[model samples]
Target chain A: MVQPEQIKQWIEAGLDGARVTVVGDGHHFEAVIVSPAFDDKSMVQQHQLVYQVLGEKMKEEIHALSMRTLTPEQAAQQGE
Target chain B: MSVQDRIKEQIVSEKIMLYMKGTPQFPQCGFSGKTVQILQACGARFGAVDVLADPEIRQGIKDYSNWPTIPQLYINGEFIGGCDIITELYQKGELQKMVMAAQG
Candidate 1:
């Protein structure tokens, strides 16, 4: 089982500027990630970016991961 | 036919296609169940494949869409996100618009 902090760290390491909040019970996780990289991307593209960052962990460690990807601007607007 | 070919045919043939863990009436996964509810709420007439019932499709779908999860949605042969994206889109009323456009 992967820790939430590990997930957070991986995302932060992968994206240039990212703020990720992860909550989970080992297997299933939910993430709210704000990143400059997400700007101008569609929702599917935004998610694919995150998925690419996680790499093989997405297939092996994480049983389920639901994400809310946002641009820094959108995150600020939403007060996230 | 290859699995990719089969998936291509499935997605293109259905205006709104859902590859889920189980049927709408009996969703095996919570995410799948929630997705079904969202689609029903939108009054979307979608075709669904219970991946749990078909091992080939269960695995083929992930590769087909390059997405690592179940409960994936496709509209007009395009890959939409999974449960999270679907819920967000439905909440923002974008999903309804897409469904309307597809049905028209």
Candidate 2:
């Protein structure tokens, strides 16, 4: 049972200037990550950056992760 | 042909393709089921590959797309994304436009 903060920390550490919010019940997790690094990257590429942060933890600890990744501007414009 | 070659061939042949955990009629994973749902909503004429039935293509796809997950969608030979991205796109109504454009 991984803590939400753990996931958030990993993501924040991975992406510079990233704002990560994570909510989950152990095996399943959902995340909303806003990052400047995501700017100009395709959706696939944005998700790839998140996956890189979790590394083997994604394959091991997390059963499933559903995430919404966005650029800071997109997040702000959406008033999120 | 190698699995990679076959996967590439499949991608090239199908305008809208889904590499999923189970057949669209009976999707094994929630993600795959949801993805198929979106494609159906788009009224997309898509070809689906059940990864569970072909372990070679299943593992090979991860390498092919460099994405770790099933229920991957490819439109016009381009890797769109997995379930979460698809869900988000559907919510924003971008998926409909993309799907329609792919076939148009």
Candidate 3:
């Protein structure tokens, strides 16, 4: 079983200054990833970057990952 | 025709196309089901290809899009994204606007 923290660690290692929250039951996962790298990127590009972090885990271990990716500005705007 | 050529033709022919796990009326995957719902919610009449039924596409699409997932969406031959991106767009009411723009 994959721990949420492990997923968080992987993402953190891949992205700089990323605020990541992941919750899952080994098979399925949901993540809200806030990162500076996501700025000026398209939604697909943002997700692609996060996907790059997980790599083979996404194919072999995790069944699904529903993610909400945002930049710091977008995250702040979300609070408004 | 080569698979790449065929894939290109399909996208070129359909203004709105979805490559999903199953048919819109009876989706196989939850992500595919949700994506179908969102597309319908946008009032978009789209063409759907059930990737599960076609092994080549099931594997080929990942290579084609460089994305390792099903339920990929295209509008006006533009690669929009998969379920997550679509869900975010839908929540922001941007999906409907995109659909309308594609239809125009």
Q: Which should have the higher DockQ, number 1 or number 2?
A: 1
Mark the regions of model 1 whose C-alpha exceeds 4 Å error after superposition.
Answer: none
Per residue, candidate 1 scores C-alpha lDDT tens digits across B1-104 of 98888989988888999999989999999999999999999999999999998889889998877788899999999998899999999999999999999999
Query: Model 2, which residues run further than 4 Å from truth?
Result: none
Residue range A1-71, candidate 2, lDDT tens digits: 79889999999998999999999999889999999999999999999999988888987888889999989
Q: Candidate 3, fnat value?
A: 0.69
Sorted by lDDT (best first), the order is 1, 2, 3
Model 3 steric clash pairs: none
Model 3 TM-score on a 0 to 1 scale: 0.95
What ordering of candidates by DockQ runs from best to worst?
1, 3, 2
* Candidate RMSDs in order: 1.1, 1.3, 1.4
- DockQ of predicted model 3: 0.78
The list of candidate 3 runs beyond 4 A from truth reads none
- Every model's DockQ: 0.81, 0.73, 0.78
Judging by lDDT, tell me the better candidate of 1 and 2: 1
